[model samples]
Every structure is written in C-alpha cells, then in structure tokens.
Target chain A: MPVWQRIYEEINDPGFVILCAAQDTGGEAAAGPIFDAANATFIQVVDPDHIISSAFNFVNVPSAAWVDEQGKIVRIDEGTYSKLHELGEGDTKISFGTDVYSVALKDWVAKGSDSAYVQSAKTVTGNIRQHSSDQLKADAAFRLGNLFRTHGYADKAEHYWDLARSLNPDSVNFIRQNLTLSEEGSAGETFRDLMGDYVKSGKDYYRPLDIQSPLQPKDEDR
Target chain B: MAKAMMAYPELRHPFAEKPIHAEGSTTVLYQGRSITLARTGAGAGLLIQPDDLPGINGFTLKPEGACYEDLCVPIGANLLVDQQGEQWFDLTGFADLLGQPYVADSEQRVWSFAEIPAKRDGMMLDAMAPDFKVTDREAQVVSMADLKGKKALIVTWSSW
Candidate 1:
C-alpha cells in the first residue's frame, strides 16, 4: 500500500489515481491506520462484506483492478503490490509483485491504451470463472462469522468461521481468523507458519501472476 | 443486556465502533440501518414484514416471486409467517424452499443467508464489474457510479 501511495502521489495530478477497498471486516477503525500511515489520501474505502472480491472474482488481498478513463475495466484482479524488494530485515522477509507491477502501472498511467499492458476483453472475461459451489457457500459463512466475531460472540463466530474454512480451505484469511475464535480451533501459530503448512499441503493459496500482453489472443488461437 | 454491555467501556471490545444489536425489536446491526427481524413463535427462522423485505434482504415480491434484480425466488403464501392473521416472510423457509444454503443459530439469535448459486452461474465469466458500495473514513457512502468518469485502479487489501 505504501508502495502504491508513492506512485499515486507521483502521478495523481495527471488523472492517475488509486482507490483502495480494504477487506477488513471490522471496517474503518480497524483498517484506517495503514492508509493513514502510508499517507494515501486518494479515495480510500473499506469492504467489510467482500463485495468487490466476489464481484470481481479475486480471492486474495493485494489484488487490483485497473479501469480506464471511460469506465471500462482494463484489468480485473491482477497481481498488485510492488514486488521490488524484500519487506523485512534478513530472514523475516516477503516478496511481492513490486518492480514488475510498479513499472506496469506507470506505463499504463503514462501511455494509457497505447500501453502494451492493457488486456483484451475476451481474456479479461476468460480469466474469471464460476467459482465452485463451495466457494460461494464460503462467502455466506464468512459473512456470518465476521458478524459474530465483531460482536464478541466467540463461540458463534467460530461455528460459522470454521464452516467457512471447511467450505473454502484455500482462504488462509479464514484459517488465521478462525484460529482465534475457539480453543479447539486454535493453532496459536503465526500466519507464516500456517501459510507454510497450506503450501506444503498443496493448496495454491498465492496466485502466480502473468501480466504480459494480458489482452492478446490465447496461444491456441494464435 | 446487549445494550448494557455496549454502554460499559470495559465490557465492549476496545476497538469495535458499533454495537451488535440495536436498542429495539426492529433491528439487528450488520450493515446499513440493520435488518428488521422478529422472533415468530419457537422457530428456526426470522420473520420480516413483506413491506420491509427489500431492506432485509433486497428481495421484493412481485406478481411472479421474491425478485432480486432480474432473479426471482418463486414464493407463495405457504412460506409466509402467520401470527394471529398478521403475516411476514419466513426467511429460513424461503431460503430452504429455494434450495439455498443458510445457517441460523437460535442460541445466538443470529443468522446468515447466501446469494442463490444461480446468481453466480449467471455472474461467472462476465467481464463487467459488479457494482458495490463502501464508506470512507468520514463515514460517507461511495458507490461504483461515483467513480464513473475516471480511470480507476482499485486495490483490495488488508492491514492484518
């Protein structure tokens, strides 16, 4: 976010803007600090209900949708975040779509449609799919669990959240949040540890992004 | 008792800004003005007045059925709640009738309803973005329409 804020600050005067829809179910009080700390003043909002995620078909956070000036979506839920560098000191580290995404974003802002980064409409629609029935079910479970968890109903929260996890096991967010809801469900481990376990178990939690000429015809057609 | 809990700072979670339940029989706070739900008899479902249907779940009854946008769940009087001749829709029964998944905890007095799977069937693989609304830090509501004229890069992320 801080990374995008820097880019947003740099080019916003030219009509290049960044808007954020935070996925914190707790809404503003919980999610505002990061925006503030990053000095991101451009239109910031929160999606406690995960509306944007379900609508755009993006499952994870740090995902982005690029819409052109004409209100057409140029790209929906592509790899965001500046994968430019390691996040922490030494062993405690993180890698994101830093330089690649930043360079691509700037190219779009500077060049618009002429930029090679824009995607074809067919490819855009093709990338999304009818999420499995379980995933749709998971959305409801997450909604219910989020409500209970926010209201201090620990056990009730666990019931639905655990249901969410079972319904959509790849959602690490659900697992981390559920672990805190009940002792029986608790892992008392960090997100890194649990995310590692998910990886070991062969859950494709992180999406590998291929953003080059995303609009071009599929290889089969060409 | 829930209100009383909200009144006490120590009783409330230090970070939460809103109460779970409002101070009347007409509301359960999850979003917006909250939903109007009444406990009808010793049952597993919630009863919402037909006139208040839209606010409760965005379902509007028409000549055909309980319609949402272009989709409708065909319902009849059989699904209506009855208490001394006054009637409302049985939320659970309506969902069950439509074959949609839902969960209600009578003990917690809370429930959740999911979108009909058919909606996803229609929505999946569509290129157009689904319209959604959210609030800024100042509590002002913003919708997709508000950003109509400009190029937008919408990022969905979290602090945790």
Candidate 2:
C-alpha cells in the first residue's frame, strides 16, 4: 500500500490511477484493517470473490495489469515493483520487481499510448494465455477452499486445498493463503518449507515482465 | 446486511440428503448436484447412467453430437470409450477433450466446473472490461460500471 501510494502521488497529474483490488474472500473484515490503517487515498475496491483474477487470467496477488488511458490493457506482469531497486535490495529479498517496471510505468503515463511499453494488440493477446485445464480446476478448488476456510470449517477447507495444491503444484500463491489462514495469521513454517521447494525448482516463479524490451527513455530510446 | 456464512451452519444443497445407491455404485456431486457413477460390468470403467448423462454435465446426448442447443461438439466414438468390450463414458477424460476444466476430490465425491473462456482467440485488447460489483470499506456497493470510460490500473493483491 505504501509503494502504491507513493506511485499514485508521483503520476496522478498524468491521469494515472491505481485501483487496488484486494482479493480477500473474507471481504472487508479481513482486508479492511490493512487498507484502513494505510490511510490510502486512492481507489480501494475489495474483490470479494476474485472476479478480477478470473477475468485477468492471473492466479496470484501483487500481480498488476497496466491499462492505458483508453482502457485497453497495455501490459500485465506478475512482479510489478513499486520502487526502483537499489544494490543489496535483492539480498534483502524484500522488494519483488525490478526498477524497470516503475520506469516503464512512468513512461506509459507520460507518453500515453505512444509509449513503447504499450504493446500491440496482437502481442498483448498472445501474451495472455488462457488457464490450463488443471489450473482452471485449481482456481475453482481454491475458491471453494477459501469459502470454507473463512466460514470456520478449517478441516473442510484443508481438504479442498490439498486437492488444489496437488492439481497445481506450482501455485505457491494459493498454497500460501491457505497456510497463512491455518497458521494463526502467519504463513509460518509451512511457508518456509514451500519456499525451499519453490526455490530449488527455479521455475518462472515470479513471472516478471520482460524488462529487456526497449521502451522510450527520457534522454533517448533504449 | 449479508449474514456471516457460519450463521447458517446447516446450509447445503437440498438434495444433499442421503439417497439410495445402486449396488457397486459411487456418488459424486457435480456442480453441487448429486449423480451416481457406476462401474462397467466388464473391466473397471466409470459410466454415468444414460438417463442421468444430461445431469452429469448438461450435455444432451444427441446423435448429431453432445448437443447443447445448436452447438453440438461431435465426440463420436471418442465420447464412449470401450474397455474390454464394455463401453463407458470416462467423465474425467471427456472433460479434457471438451477443454472444460473441473476439480474433483474422489474421497469427498465432489466435482466443480469452471466457465470456459469465450474470448481467448486474440481479442483481449479489443474485448470490453468485465463489470463486477464489490463493496467499499464502508460496505457500500460499488461496481466497475461506475467508473466507465476511465482507465484503471487494476491490482490483484493479498494482505499476506
């Protein structure tokens, strides 16, 4: 929330708006305190059932889709950074995305649709892959699990979560939320155990935007 | 005000009550609707009763195809797989062929289906944003339509 608030403040004049859709199935009761405490001035829409995730074809949170002033999705990346990264920040393992995302976001806001970050329609569509059969099933399972978990049926929730994790073994996002709920508000040791495996696997785990692609630079085009 | 779900602990499908089961048959709830899966008389292959096939997944078995209105996807002999001279429709396998996604917990006998994306073939940018209603911090209802014509940097996030 701090990161977003900073970005929103930086580029609000250029018609840049940040709409944070909190995907908490527990509704406001679960997500309210965090945003309320943040004193966020930007738009905060509580996504009760994850309608945005299902529509955007993204499975996890902290994932952002860049929409242009015309309302077309310009870019969608998982590891969207709020601040430019500094040296040793990677070692701290605190920030998610690199400095490139913020740079690109500002470029888009300043240049409008003409920004090189604005991908072609074909490219955008091609980049957006539909969820695989298993992933789709996992989405449903996770939804069902979330419903049960929030309703005090931890045992029942665990059953569905096991099925979801089995079907989409790589989905740490789904697994993390479930574990956090059961572990009395902390992801705890289960998160560490899962992270160990996740790191060893070394898949495209974060799914960051391809930063190497050239975008308009302030001085000249890269 | 929406009552907390736990306030109604007894909530369940009306048909979720105990039902008579055929010999050697297992029950699975499809979309919260109960249906029995019976094993083929020959080698073990699962089949939904012909009469109950429509209820299984809303596919009306038509000679033309798995007819749902005018759209009939021809599953052909592929629809019914034969194992050891006994024909049975493999529910799991059929779902894969249709590109429909489903989640099943065999132990709990629950199967859930998800909607197939209608616009995946390269119209994402041109496609209009899907509208949805959600509540603000004050619990007042708001919707995507309320912000029409404005660009939104939609962020999907979790507090954890």
lDDT of each structure?
0.63, 0.60
Interface RMSD of 1: 7.3
Candidate 2 accuracy as lDDT: 0.60
- Identify the CAPRI category of the predicted complex in candidate 2: incorrect
lDDT of 2 by residue, B47-147 (tens): 55455667666667777767654456677575576566655666655566667676554444445555444323323546344444555666566555565
Q: How well is each residue in A1-222 modelled by candidate 1, as lDDT tens digits?
A: 777787787676557667788776555665677788888888788776676665566767777788777666666655577655566776878654545676777777888877777776666666664466677677777777667656677666667777877887766556543333323232334455877787899755545555543333222211
The segments of candidate 2 whose C-alpha lies over 4 angstroms from its true place after superposition are: A13-16, A25-27, A84-96, A184-187, A212-222, B1-98, B103-112, B119-135, B138-148
Q: Where does model 1 sit among the CAPRI classes? A: acceptable
lDDT of 2 by residue, A1-222 (tens): 777777777777535567787876555666777788877777787774465666666666677777755556666745666655454445665534556777777777778777766765555565564567777677667656554454455666667777777877766566655544442333456676777888788855556566563543331222
User: Chain B alone, TM-score of each model?
Assistant: 0.68, 0.48
Q: Using DockQ as the measure, which candidate wins?
A: 1
True contacts kept of each: 0.50, 0.44
